[model samples]
Target chain A: MTTSTPLQPVVQARGLVKRYGRVTALDHADFDLMPGEILAVIGDNGAGKTTLIKALTGAITPDQGEIRLDGKPVRFTSPMQAREAGIETVYQNLALSPALSIADNMFLGREIEKTGVLGSLFRMLDRAQMRKEARAALTRLGLMTIQNIDQPVETLSGGQRQGVAIARAATFGRHVVIMDEPTAALGVKESRRVLDLILDVKKSGLPVVLISHNMPHVFEIADRIHIHRLGRRHAVVRPSDVTMSDAVAIMTGAMEPPAQAA
Target chain B: MSTDQPSSAPRGPQAFEKVLPENEAPVRFEAERESGIKRFQNLLHSHPTAIPGIVLVASLVFFSVMVGGRFLHPFNFSLIVQQVMIIGIVGIAQTLVVLTAGIDLSVGAIMVLSSMVMGRLAVEMGVPTPLAIAAGIGIAALCGFANGVLVTRFRLPPFIVTLGTWNIFFALNLWYSASETIRAQDIEASAPLLIFFGQAVELFGARLTYGSIAMLAMVAIAWYVLNRTAWGRHVHAVGDDIESARLAGIRTDRVLLMVYVVAGVICGIAAWALIGRIGSASPQAGQTANLDSITAVVIGGTSLFGGRGSIVGTLLGALIVGVFRNGLALSGVNVLWQEFAVGVLIIVAVAIDQWLRRTSR
Candidate 1:
C-alpha cells in the first residue's frame, strides 16, 4: 500500500532451491527484504520457511540461487561468514552457553583481545572491557533488570535470557538483524517486552527479517508480510492491505494471492 | 457559604482526590533468604575444590593425631609429595580432557608406552637419550592426534574411542617393550637423564625430589593457561555446549582436537616424570593410573560432565589421595582398607559434585 514508487531492497534471493533426500524443502523460492522495514515471514508447517531463512543466513547452502546484498552477489559458506557480512541471526533456541557469564556469552565468538604483546602472545582477553561494554549494550537496549553481567546465563529468567541474546545481536549486527521466533517461548509479559525490543531495534534504523507463526504479532509490527506456501513464496502483501484470515487463506492455499500483491 | 470563606471551601472535585480506592499492590513472591546450610552449599558449588581441600586437611590432622604426630614430620610430608607426583602429573592430562567433557582412558597407556620408547631407544637401540625422549613424546602426540581425528572426523564418541585406544596402546606397549621391565641399574648407567628426576634436594630439612617440583610447575602452568587464555575459554565453551559454541562461530572440532593433542603432550611429560619417580621404564608401571587420575580429577572438583573445573583443584585432589594412603598406612590400617577408603572417597566426591550442581540449579 505504501508502494508509491519502487524501492531498492537490502537483500534479495532469486530461484532458490534445496532438496533433502526425497523431500523438496525449498522449491525455487524468491524473496526480498526492503531496506529499513520489518519483513515478516509466515508459513504453515512444512512450508519451507526455515529452509529459506537458513539459506539466506548461510546456515545452509541452497542447491541453486542468486543472493545479492547491497546489489552485490555474495556467497557465505558458514554462519561466521554471514556474520562478517553484517548479517546476525538470533535463533529460536537463543544459542547462549548456559554455563558462561552474560558478558562472556555476549562476546562469545568475537572476543575482544587485550592490546599489545600480551594479547598477541598469550591471546589474553580484555575481560574488563568486554564486561563494561556488555553492560553498556544491555543498558542501551533497556535490559537493566539484569544486575550482574558476570552471572551465568542459566541464572536468568526466560525473558532476561532472550533480552541478552537480543542485546548481543543488536550490539554486533551492523547491517541486518534476523530473528527466528524470538518470542515463541515467552509468556505474555515477556513477549510484550520482546515485541517492544523489536520495535526498539527497528527505531535504531536497522532492517529486520522476522520469522514467526504468530499472526497478530506479525501484523502488528510488520511492514510487509511474506506468506510462504508449498515450498515457495505464495504472496507478499502489505499488512494494511490484508486481513489475518486472508493471509492465512493464502498461506494454506484456500485462496490465491491478490493480484496487486503478486 | 460566606464570601470570605469561599476561598477555603473545597473545590467542586479536587484532582488529587481518589476516584476509587487504590488497590493494594499485587502479592509478589520474593525468594526467601538462604539459610546457613544453603549458603554453604552455594559456596561449595561455586568453588568445587573446597570440599576436597577440607577433606585433605582433615585427613592430615587425623593421621597426625592417630600416629602421635609422626605423620606431621617434614620427612613424611615430603614423602607424601613424592608418592603423589606421578598421579599429579598424569592428572594434568586427564584434567584437560575432562574439561572438554571428554575422557582419555588411554592416558596411562600413552605414558607407559612413551616411557618404554624412551627406555628401548636409549638402552637397546643406543639412540641418544634426549632424542629418544623427544621421539617418545612425539609418539604420544601422534596417538593423541589419532584419537582426536577419530573423535572429530569420524564422529565417534570419545569414551568408546579412547577405551578402544587404551587397549590398543597397552597391547602396543607390551609388544614394543617385549614385556621386559627395564632395570633401574641399566637405566641409570645408559640413560642417566631418564632417571634425573629421581635426584633429590634437601629443602628445609625435608627431601624434595625433582619429580615433585616438576609436577607442581606443570600444574601451575596448567592453571595459568586454563584460567587466562582464549584457547582455554574455547575448550570450556565447547564442553559447556557444543552446539552453542559452534553457533558462536567457534571451531569446536579444532578445540576438541587441540585438547586431545595437548592432553597427550602432558601425558608424555608425565611419562618422563614417571621414569624419574620409578628410576625405570617398565611396561607394568601406571597400571592403575587411568582410574587414579580420574579419581584425582573428580575429587579435585573438576566435573566429569566437563566445562567447569580447575587445575589447582586437581593438584589438591592428588595430594588428598596421597595423604589418605599414607595416613592409613601410618595408622596401621590394612592395605585392603586403604583401597576401600579410596573407593568411598571417590563415591563421596562424585556425590558432593552432584549435590553442588543441584544447589546452583
Candidate 2:
C-alpha cells in the first residue's frame, strides 16, 4: 500500500473537555481539519459536535483544550475575536433582517461609508458603493437571479435567502467557512443549490466545515468524515472507504471504530 | 485530484465524479405576477411618506372646497401651522420611540415638566435665562436616560416602562409646579428668552413663528440622519429584528438606550416650543399632547411595529390632524363631530399600516 504524507491541519483541537455541572459535554475530544479539504462531522444527539464547534469557534472556552490555527496556539473568548481571525460562521437561523434590502442586510454591521465630508463629517453610508460591491459579491457566486439588489429579504424565497447567507459568508470568510446545517431547512432543490454553493466555496480556496445529518450528502462532498461518539473523535475515515450504514452505525455506537483513522 | 479509494485508484476520472457534484444548473424561475394592489402596497411600503402626503393634500382640497376662499387663504394656512406646532414637535420625539417599536406615553409629561423647570428656574428662582433653558433640556434628557436604563437593563418592555414613568413624571410635574400655571406676564418680564420661539415673522400675509420654522428644520435634520447615516440603518435593523442586529454585531442595548436619550432631547425641545406656543409653563398644559402626538405619528404612516416609516410622513400626519380639526370647525361641524372625525382617521391610518405591512410577509 502506498501512503502519501499529509500536511498539518489548518485548524486542530486536542484534549478538549467541557463540563456543564454534572454533565460532561466534551470529554477529551480531539479534532483535525486539513487544509483545502471539505471536512464533515457527524454525530448522534448529545454527542457534543456542537460543543466541539463552539470550542473551536470561540463561542465558548472549553475547560481544557489547546486550539491551534496554522500551527500557532491561540485563545479566543468571543465570536468576534474568532471572526477577526479569519473564521466566519453561517449560523443556522441565518441572522438576516427582513425589512432591509439585500445590500443593507449584507452590510449591516460593517457598512461602507462615503469618503470625505459626507462620510466622516456627516457619517453617511456610501449606499451606491455598497450596492455595487454587493452586486459584485452576488455575481461572483453566480447568484444573479436576484434582479433587484434593493429588494427586502422578506421578498426572497427560502432558497434565495440561504443563497444570500452563503454568499455573505463567502464574501467575508478569509480562511475557513463553517456552516451549521446549511441544507437542513431547505427543500430538495434548495438543498441541491446549497450543496453546489458549498463546492464553489471550496473551489475559491477556503476549507469548509459542514455539520449535517444527510448521509448521502456527507458521502458525496466530504473528502474525509469525522465520526464523533461519546463526546470524542471515534475515527476519521475516507468517504470512499466507509459505507453510509457503517458511518451511521459507528456514529450511533452499534459498531466498532475503524482500526486505521484517516 | 486525490482519491482515497485504493481499489478504485485506477478509475481516476470517475472517482472524482463520485465526490464532486455534477455541474450546477442555472437558477431557473420567472418572477411571479403581482396584483395591482400588491404593487401599490410595495410602492407605499418603500416610500412610507406617500399616503400621508396624499392625505394632507386631499384634506386641503376637501376643506377649501367646503369652506371656500377663507380656507385656502395664507393666513388660515398659517393658523393651521401654529395650531399643530406643539404636536408637530412632540410628534418628532414620539416618532423616534415608535420607530424602535416602542411608544413613549410620558412625552407630554416630560415636555410639561421641562417647561415648568425652565419657567420656575428663570422667573421664580432668578437663574440666568439660558442656564434655566439648558437645565430644562438636560433634565428631560436625564429623564429619557432613566427610561432607557430601566428598559434595557431590566429587560422590561418599553410600553410598560414608559407607561409607569408617565405617571411618575406627571406627579412630579404637579408637585414641582405647585399645580399652578406660571403667569405669562412674569415670564415676559423676567425672561423674554423663555418665549423667544413665539416671536412671529410676517411673510406674504402669513405670520410664521420661529417655533414653526424650527420644527421644519428639525424634520429635515431628522430625515437626513435617518436616511443617510449608519446609525439610522442600525436603528431600523434593531427594530426590525433585534436578534439579527445583535448577531450582525450591533450593541442592541446601547442602540436602544441612545434612541431613548435622543427621543428625550427632542422632547425637551418640544417643551420649549410648548412654552412658546401656549405663552405659559403650566403643569396642566399638554394634558392631551401624548395622545395627540401618537395620533400624528400613526396618521403619518409610521408603522407602530417599528423598523419602518419616516419623519416626513410624521410631519404630514400632524398637518392632517390640524387641517381636519380646523377645516371641520370652519365648516360648522360640532366639536364632538370633529373629535369623532379624528378618531376615525386614526383607525383608518392604522388599518392602512397593517395592510401595507402584510406585503412583507
Candidate 3:
C-alpha cells in the first residue's frame, strides 16, 4: 500500500484479550503503528474500537496480551505509567482543569520545584520556569495567540482548549500519541484546527493513533486505516485501496475485509 | 484521500453537527465587546479573592461610620480576633475540605473530641500534660484520617461520610468526657499547658492571646501551602475536576485523603484553642462551630462546589463574621438581630457565588 514500508512498528499489540464477565470488549485484537504515520482506528459502535485503544493506552488492562514499545515487552497499570513510557493521550473530554491556569494544568501533576530551600523545605513551585516552558511548548505547536499563560482553561474558547490539550500531548508524547475522539465535541472550524494540529504533531516525527467516528476526517488525514470489527482488529488498509462505501461495508460486517497486514 | 469527491459536513459523522446547538455554541466564540457590568463581572471572576476583600473593607468602613470610634478601636479589633479564634481555626480546616468540593460536618465534633481527650487524659487519668495533648491531637488526626479512608477507599460521598462520622465522633466525645465539663480551676491545677493559648500579651490597648496569634499564623502558613506548592495546585485540580485530575495522572485519591487528614489536624489544633478560649473543656461547647466555619468559608468567596477559592479570603471571612457580631452587639442590636444579619450575609454570599459560576459559559 505504500512506496516503502518501515521494518519496525513503533507500537505493537498482539493477542490483546479483554472481558467483562459475559461480554468481551476486545477479543484477541492485534495492532501495529509504523513510524511517523497517522493510524486512524475506525469501527461501528460496539465493535471494540474504544476497548482496543484503552488497552493500548493503559486506560484498561487486557485479560491477555503482549504490548511492545520500541521492541521491549511492557505492561501498564495506569495512565501515569503509560505516560512515563512516553505515551500521551488526549481524551475526548479535553481533560483540562477548568479553574487552573494554562501552565498549572500543563504541569498539573509533574510540577517543577524551585532549586533550594524554598522548594526542598517549603515545597514552593518554580512558577516562572514552568510558565516559560509552557510558553515554549505552545510556541512549538504554533499556538502563541494565547497571550496569557496564567489564564484559566475555563476562560478559553472550545478551540483554544482543544489546542491546549493537543499541545500538551504533542509536547510530551515522545514515542506515540493516542487520541480518542479529539474532534468529537468541537465545531467545524475547531475540528479543522485539531486536524491541522494532528499533522503538525506528525511533522515533529511522533506517530499518532486517532480514534475517530468521522469518515471524512479519517479519509482526509489517516495514513493507515485499522478497521476493527467483532471485538478485534479486522484489517489494516490504506485509503487509496478502497472506497468509503466498501470500508463501511467491511466495518458493519456486510462485506468481507480485504486481506492485509495489521 | 480517495479520488472521489471529499465528504462534506452533511456526509461527515452524523453526530458532529448535531451537537452544534446555537444556545451552547457561544463557548466557542465569546469575543465580542463586553458591557460595563460584564467587564466588572469578568474582573471579579478572575480574582476570586477580591470580592471578599472588598466586602470586608466596606463592612469595616460602614460599621466604623455607624458605631464611631469604638467599632474601629484596636481593642475592639483584638476582641473580634479572640471571639473568632476557634471558628477561625476550624474555618481553616473547613476551607481545605470545601476547596476539595467536600464538607466536614464533623469539624466541631472532632475539635470537642480532641479537647475532651486532652482534658480527660490529663486530669482523670493523670497522663503527662504534653503526652495527653499529643494523644489528643493524634486521635484527632486519626478521626480525620478515618474520614479520609471512608471517603476514598469506600468511594462514599464526603458529605455523607462526614455526617455519619460527626455523630460517631460526637458520641465518642460524650463517652470519653462522660458528658461533663472539666472545671477551669481543676484544669488550671493539673495542666497549665491546656490553657497556654489563653495567655495574652498587651499591645497598646489590645490583648492578643497566643491562640489568636496562632490562628493568624495558621492562616499565613495555610496560604503559603495553598498558593506556593504543587500539592496545593493538585488540591485545586482535584476539586476543579477530579476526573481531569486523575486523567492528568495526579494521585487524586491520595490528594483527597491528604485533604481530609490535614483538615483533621487543624481541627485538633482548633480544639486546643477551644479550651483556651472557653477557659474549660466542656462537651456541650461548639454545638454551632461546624456551621459557623462553613459560614466563614462560604462568605470568603470559596465555592461550595470546589476548585475555586483563597485561604486569605477565608481568614477575612472569619473576621467579617467576628466584626458583625462585635459591631452589632456594640450598637445595641439584640442577639437575634445579629444572627439575622449573619443569615442574610450567608445568602448574599451564596447568591454571589452562583452568579459568578453561571458566567463561565
Candidate 4:
C-alpha cells in the first residue's frame, strides 16, 4: 500500500536502551532519519520520545546500541560534541537567554571579534557585522517586522522568538535539526509561521527530526512518521500510505482495522 | 510549503495552539503599543532592577535638606568625605564579592587585623614604615586568599567560609593588641609617612582630604573594573547564570576566588585610611564596617541575585550615608540616635526603591 519508495536514511539508530532509576525510559528503540525529509516522532506522555532524542543528541547516555550519522559510527559525549558533528536540537524551552537581545542570544558563547590588539585592548564587539548577519537570518525567516535586533528576547512574542531560535539552528550550519515540540507554547498564527520556517529549512537541503504528540501536525508536515511503543519504534509509515485513523490506531496500540480499509 | 497557504490563521502542531491558552496571549507584542520615547522612559522607570540606586540618590537629597543646609556646606561636606572614606573603600571591596551573590562578613575584622599588624611591625619590630605598611596589607591579602581557597577548593558556601574567617581575624586582632589601642606615638615612630592620609588638601573655596581623594580614586577604578573590563562581563555572566556561564566555558570558580582576594586587598587599603584618620589602631576599630558596607551595596542598586550593579551607584550610596550622619551631627542631633537615623534611612531608601521598581514594571 506504500506509494513512494523509501529514501536514504541520514541517521540510523540500532538497539538503543536507557533506564532511569526504576523506570525504563527507552528499551532497544531503533529510529531512522531520511535525507532532506521531515520525520515526525509522536507518542503519548512518558513514551520515551524525549529520552530517545536526548540520548541521540548527547544530552543523556544510553546503555546500549549504536547511532550512525551520515553512515559514520559515532558516540556524542556532550551537546557540544553533537553540535560539532552537525547535529542541532531545539528544545521545548528553546534555550534562549531572555536577558540578552536576539543577536546576542544567537551568538551567546561564540562572538565574532574584530581584528588587532586594539580590539583586544578595547574589548569592542563587532556590532556592525553581527547586526548585518542577524538581520539576514531574520529576513530569511520572514521576520522582518522585528525592527530592533538589539532589544532583549523577553520582548518578543512566542512565534517571533521561536522563529529566531529556528533561524539560529539553521544559521549554525548543522546538517540535522531536531526540534523538541517547538510549537508547544505558541499561538495558531505563530505555530503556522514556525511550520513555514520548517519548510524553508527543508528547502535549504537540511533534514529535520520533529518530535510531537500532535497527529494532525505530523500528517501535515512530516514526509515519514515513526511511532514508539513500549520501548521500541513500532512503525515508520509515509503520510500518503495511511489515513489519520490508521496512524492513530498504530499510535494507540490497537491492532483492529476499519471495515473500509479491508 | 504544501501550497504556500495564506489563510488568516497559520496552522501547525495542534497541541500548542488548541490547548495552553497561556501561550496564545501574545503580551510581549503589546510592548510595542507605546511610542519609542515612552518605551525608553518605561525601560528606565520600570527597571525595578535599579531601585537601590534610586533610593541612594533620594536619601542623599532628603538628608541634605533635613540638616538645615549644613549638609552641603563646604567644610561639613569635606568632613563627610573624610569620615566615610574607610567605609567607601571597604564598600568597593564588598561590591566585588556581592556582585557574585556572595558576602564577605570578615571585612571589618580583616581591616582591624591588617592595621594591628602594620602598627606592631612598625612599632615593636623596628621594621621600616613602608615595609610595615606593605606587611599589613599583605596580611589582609593572605586572609582573603584563605577565604577564597575555602570557598572555591573546598566548595564551602561563601557565607560559612567568610563567617569563619571573620571570627578568626577578630580573635587575632584582639590577641595582637591585647584589647588595648595602638597609640599614634607607637605608630608615628614606625609609619609616619602613612599619616599623611589624615591631612587635608585645600582646593578653591574648600578642602578635599587625602583619604577622601584616595577613596574617590579607588571608587573610580572599581567602577571601571566592574563595568568596562572583560573580567567584568564574565563576572556578571557568572552571577546572572552559573550554569550558562559554565556551558560557555567560563572559569567561575577561579573568578569567585579572584573576587574574594580583590576584596581582601581593598580591606588592607581601608585599614591604612582608618588608622590614619583615627590616629590609632584599636581592636575595636571598624566594628560596624561590615554591616555598613553591606548597606551601601544594597543601597547602590546592585541586585542581591548578582549579574546587575554599578560602582558609581555604590559610591553615591556611600556618600549619601556619610552626608546624613555629618549633617545630623552638625545640627545638634543626639549622637546616640545617629545609628537609628541611618537605619531608618536604609529602610526608607529601600522602600522608595521598591516602589519605583514595581511602578516602572
On TM-score, the leading prediction is 3
Per-residue C-alpha lDDT of model 4 across residues B127-233, encoded as one tens digit per residue:
88788889999999999999999988998988899889999999999998788887888677666865768878787645787889999999887866664455665
- Pairs of colliding residues, candidate 4: B46-B360
Computed on C-alpha atoms, the DockQ of candidate 1 is: 0.23
lDDT per residue (tens digit) for residues A61-161 in model 1: 99898889888898988899889998989999888888788998999888888899989987888999999999999998899889999888877878899
Per-residue lDDT of model 3, residues A1-262, tens digit only: 3536556888999999999999999889999988889999999999999988888889899999899998889899888989999999999887899999999988888999999998999999999999998999999888899999999999988888988988899888899999899888887867877788898999999999999987778876888889999999898877767767777888998988777653
Best by lDDT: 3
lDDT against the true structure, per candidate, is 0.87, 0.87, 0.89, 0.76
- Give the alpha carbon lDDT tens digit for every residue of B112-162 in model 3: 999999998998899998998998899999999999999999999999999
Better candidate by lDDT, 2 or 4? 2
Model 1 CAPRI quality: acceptable
Q: For candidate 2, write residues A138-181 as lDDT tens digits.
A: 89888989999999998898888888888888888887888888
* Candidate 4: regions farther than 4 A off: A1-14, A63-76, A80-86, A112-114, A119-136, A242-252, A255-262, B1-41, B45-70, B110-165, B172-188, B191-200, B209-231, B241-282, B348-361
Cα RMSD of all models vs. native, in order, equals 7.7, 4.1, 3.5, 5.9
Worst 10 residues of 3 chain A by lDDT: A1-10
What are the per-model DockQ values? 0.23, 0.38, 0.51, 0.17
- lDDT of model 2 at position A43: 98
TM-score of chain B taken alone, every candidate: 0.91, 0.92, 0.92, 0.84
Reference-based lDDT, residue B268, model 1: 88
- Winner on TM-score between 2 and 3 is 3
What is the clash count of model 3? 0
- Sort order, TM-score high to low: 3, 1, 2, 4
